[model samples]
Target: MANIPYREVLGSLMWLQVATRPDLSFAVNMLSRFANNPGRAHWEAMKHTLAYVKSTTHYGITYCHDSNIKPLGYVDADYAGDTDRRRSTEGHIFFVAGGPVSWASKRQDTVALSTVESEYMAFSRAVQQGIWITSFMDEIGLPQDTPVLIYADNNGAIANTQNYKNHRRTKHIDIRYHFVKERTANGDIVFEYIPSSDNLADILTKPLARDAVIRCCVGIGLRDVEAGGVL
Candidate 1:
């Protein structure tokens, strides 16, 4: 396995992950990081992702035509999920017309000092995506007028964006992450705290039980084609 050239297969998986398989995004992202140094364990992980895809080939995002057309976002962070570097993974999913239209799962550029900081950065990145999407919608003649709501599971991070107080834990954070705060204040984007159990972005931040993944798949509008509904 150490001598195997795995880039081509990995690239195909990456394409599928971006195109339709939101569930495989985290696995693809994690495995891609090790593509150059793939060993037995890495190859096994790739095989696992392939197996998961084989089992859920019919899963896809369906845009419900008659529903909430405004874009809604769910953002979450796995606090220091990367064991080796202690970096957090940020995940976000944007829903429009009752289905997910865009999503992301990627490692943070720098290490976060705390869970609040990680969540803050995650929300900030979501805001950036939201802003871009809103602009694109405007160009397409479906301009959105309401604020984009970004749901977060952490209360401390939500409070940090709203209050802006330089508290001990958040005082040292970089100024760029506060972009979410500015948009939030202007009513362009709203940060709302939701129960972690209900945050669908959980799927993108880390691996979970099969049941949990199914629940998240439903949350983000990925449905099984066989039953004409969620699996």
Candidate 2:
């Protein structure tokens, strides 16, 4: 007999992803789609994921005491990543005191015709989350200064955020997403271009090699208690 009900298994995995296993967010999100019609391959994949979790059960986020480090976020999009829908996946992670506290990885709600558009959509979503988180922090007495740094790997998306003039290319985008531009111009947020290789949010949108994944996890202060390693 199977170990757990499919729904229960999926729910538990989702909770883990949200709690302390951002590394598993993409994998769990992908696997969850197969819950309704899980074949043997899907079951095997789930079991493998569980095994990985068991092996790294002691790994968790490590918050530092430093408060001088600025709050920063990285956003990325995998253009046309989904094999079935050809929709991009938007991923973002926010860090404070050198550790990630908020992250998301999900398919874009709308189909973007260009990489710039996909990146713009993803950046906008990150900006919204950034604003909300900043406000929450402020309410809790961790108020940050104006203009949080938001990193995006796409130059076009960064340019779009810094400028308001609409060209034929960007005119097709929804008006709501223009909030990124408004926030940037109003000095509430700043968009910076980061090289794709250095964008930590990349881990959320796509699978990476083992080394890269571990590097990112370490960079964000995720420690493995069992291994006595602070990563």
lDDT of 1 by residue, 1-231 (tens): 645757777999999988888888899889988987788888888888888988998887788879878899999999999999999999999989988889999999989999988998888889999998899999999999868888999998988778866677766565755677788888899888899999989999999999999889888888887779667
Candidate 2 Cα errors over 4 Å, as ranges: 1-4, 67-69, 227-229
How do all models score by TM-score? 0.95, 0.92
* Model 1 quality (TM-score): 0.95
TM-score, candidate 2, is: 0.92
Each model's total of backbone clashes: 0, 0
The Cα local distance difference test for each model comes to: 0.87, 0.83
* Model 1 C-alpha lDDT versus the unseen true structure: 0.87
Deviation in angstroms for 5 in model 2? 3.4
Q: lDDT per residue, candidate 2, 1-231, as tens digits? A: 265466677789999999888888888877887877777777777888888788778898877786544678989999999888899998999988878889999898878889999998898889888888889889889788988998889998888786767767667675745788888888888988889888889888988898988877886567986677565
RMSD of 1: 1.4
Residue 157, model 2: Cα distance from true site in angstroms:
0.9
Best by TM-score: 1
